[model samples]
Target: MAIRFESRTVDGVPLLLAFPDSNGAPWPTVFWFHGFGVDSEVHRPELRRIAEAGFLAVGVDAAGHGRRRLPDLQERIDQPHEQALRTMTRLAAQTAAEIPGLVRALADEGIADPDRVALVGVSMGGYLVYRALLEPVALRAAVSILGSPEWPEGDSPHQHLDAFCRTALLSITGERDENVPPDGARALHRRLDEQNPRSVHRYVEIPGAPHLMDGDQWAVVMDEMPRWLERYVLRPAHTTPSE
Candidate 1:
């Protein structure tokens, strides 16, 4: 079946929803969040992939992006280092706060199987994945690409490692990335390993890859990400409760 697309506003949050045209009610869902300065539409390729895999894929716009873009958002982001970091963190926080509501609205509309939900985020959106995990939302798994667990202005993900134990996580980073170094993600994996040796978490660093990944680099993510979601999110949902 062909893919179906919808431009929706749920609970005042704008979302670009994609799913299979087939009658797959209550589908497993993957929410895709784009990086800073880019809107939801920028990640349409990934959304299409997730939808092709039989999951309802949603692309979310950050607070100062897409339909919510502020007139001076670009200007604010181009400010001096310290000032720009503040603006970025603020936008990330606002975006993270909307996840729960968006998830609920989709489930209520019978579009998503709330229990089989997952998230995939790039850069700024990756920060949102970590923050959303700390909230009460029951995200089954998440893939964070080129995103850091540390928030310079808010509660860093390191401060709540316990929250991560409940969900499967795959953190991918570029070894040569200076924009968002891989060190933070490395340290996060180490801590989680120490805390729960059996936890469902993995971190991958692409050799010679930079923050702005090339097609070859993204190929690695495309290969690994869907498998992670299949193992942790999709496979689990299909199994019998007794299993």
Candidate 2:
């Protein structure tokens, strides 16, 4: 097991990285994204929990938050006033540009498997996961928490969802979530459903859960995530649209 804190310039953007310290050899890697407002601390336990389950965990604090110390356009867009679509678009572009470089660096560090990587993101991070889905890079799986695919008032993406994207996806939502209404989940699911066109995807709506149920329902997620990872992302081969 090995753990390290490192930094690298990805597409000219300075990015931060945190990896697990463990005994597993050539473990699977998790490319993690943090939720809005909160720092990396909010995601630490979740990463540790996943790492303890025998996977490499690499997390980034979305440029502005935590140690990265850059302007967080997402949070800035969420200010008291309404934000323009262009602002969100720029942030999303920055995110997409930096992610691949981050993944490459992790692979070079022996902290991630370029072929067996999975993504788990929360809230705003969840939205970014969908954005990543449209990426041409190889991704084994994605787990998005309370993120919506529907436009956030004035949000858009880098490109249209490719009909070729059959990447395994698991979008989880809390039934009682005030932050993400039921309609949003349904819409996102519907969009992905359309994007895949011929493939069947998985969407889970947990009952009696709230916006941040990490504390209350952590136990259920701990039990369920492994199977989700095993069935779709961690199998012998990465599932493709053609699979």
The top-ranked prediction according to lDDT is: 1
TM-score of 1: 0.95
Q: Which stretch of 10 consecutive residues in model 2 shows the poorest summed lDDT?
A: 155-164
Model 1, 1-243: lDDT tens per residue? 588888888888779999866687799899998988888888888888888888999998888899988999889879986787777777888888888888899999998998999999998888778877887788888998988888887687778888788788999999999888999889999998897776789999999999998999999999999988887777666542113
Q: Which ten residues in a row have the lowest lDDT in candidate 1?
A: 234-243
Q: lDDT tens digits, residues 88-140, model 2?
A: 33444456556787677667866577877777777767767777776666777
lDDT of 1 at 140: 84
The C-alpha stretches of model 1 lying farther than 4 A from their native spots are: 238-243
